[model samples]
Structures are given as structure tokens and as C-alpha cells.
Target: MPTKRDLLDLQFMDARCKLIDLAAFLDRIERHEGEPDFRLAAFREALPILLSEKPNRARAVLEALSDQTPEPIEAATIQGAFGAPQV
Candidate 1:
């Protein structure tokens, strides 16, 4: 069985992956503005990370962006697309 620290680390990694997925979902939403289902699905994926005991920093950035007027999607360009980071 994994130690507590290992489990926490795995949870953190999962949260990071969820953030990446949220970014992709956001990109898709930007491309197709009419899909509320897609946006809801993305929000569902992101909800865990947002409500986590230790919130993911990247997700926090996106959440802050989502709150502003005109939306960050319209204001600033996202630098990275979804994929596992290079080793």
C-alpha cells in the first residue's frame, strides 16, 4: 500500500492533470461558444480541484481568469495546449 505522502502526491498529480484537462475544455469552449454541456462537463472535471483541501495553483489561475469581465479567453492567449509535460 502507498504511504500517506505518496497518496497525497498522487492526488496532487491528479489535480494537475484535471487542470490540464480543464484548459483543453476551455479551449474547446472558446472554439465552440454554444456548447453549454461541454462547459458543464469541464466545470465538473475542475470542481474537484477547486474544492480540494489544497487547491491546484494552475486551476486557481484559470478560475481567476474566468471571473473577470470579457473573460481571459478573450483578453489573453493561453500559452500551452494539453499534453503531458516533457520528461
Candidate 2:
């Protein structure tokens, strides 16, 4: 049986691989000079930072919840949380 940490690691690797593949595919395509694809561009830049910090960051988050308090949130109260709906 895989532990929570083990599953998190697998999911993270899967996500990272998908993102990198997307970036590579996009790079292979011909785009107009300096056309702003801000979303993908930002993702490409952020992926490296995310990958670099992943291990320590994931450990820190998981460590904050002790053995007794296994679940991060007992229950979530979504009432009055989100404000305006995005268009």
C-alpha cells in the first residue's frame, strides 16, 4: 500500500512531466515573434521553481500535520468564502 507521501510524490511527478511535455510541444510550434502567451510562458518559468522546491515544500506541508491530526482539515466551511464569480 502506498502512503500519502508516496502518492503525493507520484502525482507531483506526473504533473511535472505533463507540464514539461506541453512546454516542449509549444516550443516546437512556430509562433509569431513576441506574441504574448502569458499563461503558458509563466507556467514554463514557474515549473522550474516548483520542481526545485517540491521536496522540501511538500515535506513542510505534510510535517505540519502530525500523526494524531492526520487530516489537514476536519471539515471545510465553504460558506462566505468565495467573493465575486469570475467572468
Candidate 3:
């Protein structure tokens, strides 16, 4: 089993790069003039989960962005997912 230190040594750079990429994405979003986007809102809502000392942060974040309608829509709108609830 890998110790915490070993995990950090192996993954820290990759994690750091992703964090930087996310920050850059946020920067681009901030520079844009756009209407409110539910997907972006959901993404922001999930950010706090990363800071929490929870074992299931990935599951929590995925759930936060998921559509929880519990039933299928009668028809397809775009034949693809919006990546977050359309709310």
C-alpha cells in the first residue's frame, strides 16, 4: 500500500497541473460576457467538496452535477447530455 507521502510524490505534479488548468478556465470564464450557465453554476457548487475531508468527494461532486429527476424525459432534446441539470 502506498503511504500518503508516496501518493503525493507520485501524483502531486499532475494534481497541480490540473489545478492550474482549472484556474485558467475560470479566468477565461471571468473574462467572457455571458449569461448565467447552470453547468458553470453546478461546477462552482462542487468546488467546495474538493476542500472537504470526505472519502467520497468524487461521488459527491458527480452527484452535485447530476440530473436527479429520477425519471426519463419523454423525448430527446439534443440527443446528448448537458453535463449538468438544466435547472
Candidate 4:
């Protein structure tokens, strides 16, 4: 297994790029004049998980954004997913 430093050396740039991209995405969202929706709300809620000392942030974040409904809906509203729950 790679050491912490070795892993950072290999992944730092890609991680930095993703961080910057996320910041840019938030910037664009802020610049728009519209009401915030579930997707934005979910994304904001997941942000703190990234900073927490969690062993599995990815799974936590995925669950945070996922629909937790135990039962199926009567019908589909759209052909594709909204990327966030409609709640």
C-alpha cells in the first residue's frame, strides 16, 4: 500500500482540480437569479461531509443526495432522474 505522502503526491493535482471545479460550479449557481432547489440543497448539505474525518465520505454523500423512499411511486414524472430527490 502507498504511504499517505505517496498517495497525496499521486492524487493531489486531480483532487485540486476537482475542488476548483466544484467551487466554480457553486460560483455559477450563485450568479444565477433563481430559487434554490433540492439538488443545490443536497449538494450544500453534503459539503461538510468532505471536511469531516469520516472513513466513507463518498457513501455518506451519495446517500445524502439519494432518495430514501421505501416504496415506488405510482408513475414516473420524467424520463430521467433529477439528480436529487424532489423533496
Give the top-scoring candidate (lDDT).
3
**Which stretches of model 1 miss by more than 4 angstroms?**
1-3, 35-87
Please say which candidate is ahead in TM-score: 2 or 4.
Answer: 4
TM-score of every model versus the real structure: 0.33, 0.30, 0.94, 0.94
> Model 4, range 15-67, lDDT digits (tens) per residue?
99999999999999999997999899989988999999979999999988889
Residue range 1-87, candidate 3, lDDT tens digits: 999999999999999999999999999999999786898999999999999998999999899999999999999978789888888
Clashing pairs in 2: none
| Pairs in steric clash, model 4 | none
Worst 10 residues of 4 by lDDT: 77-86
lDDT of 1 by residue, 1-87 (tens): 999999888798887897798689767767885645443554555456655677475766466335333434554355763322111
**Candidate 2 at residue 62, lDDT?**
35
Q: Report residue 53 deviation for candidate 2 (angstroms).
A: 3.5
Give Cα-based local distance difference scores for all models. Answer: 0.58, 0.53, 0.93, 0.92
Off by over 4 Å in 2: 1-20, 28-34, 55-87
lDDT of 2 by residue, 1-87 (tens): 999899888798887897798777777654646664544444344445545745675454333322334345577577542222211
Error of 3 at 2 (Å): 0.6
For candidate 2, the 10 contiguous residues with the lowest summed lDDT are 61-70
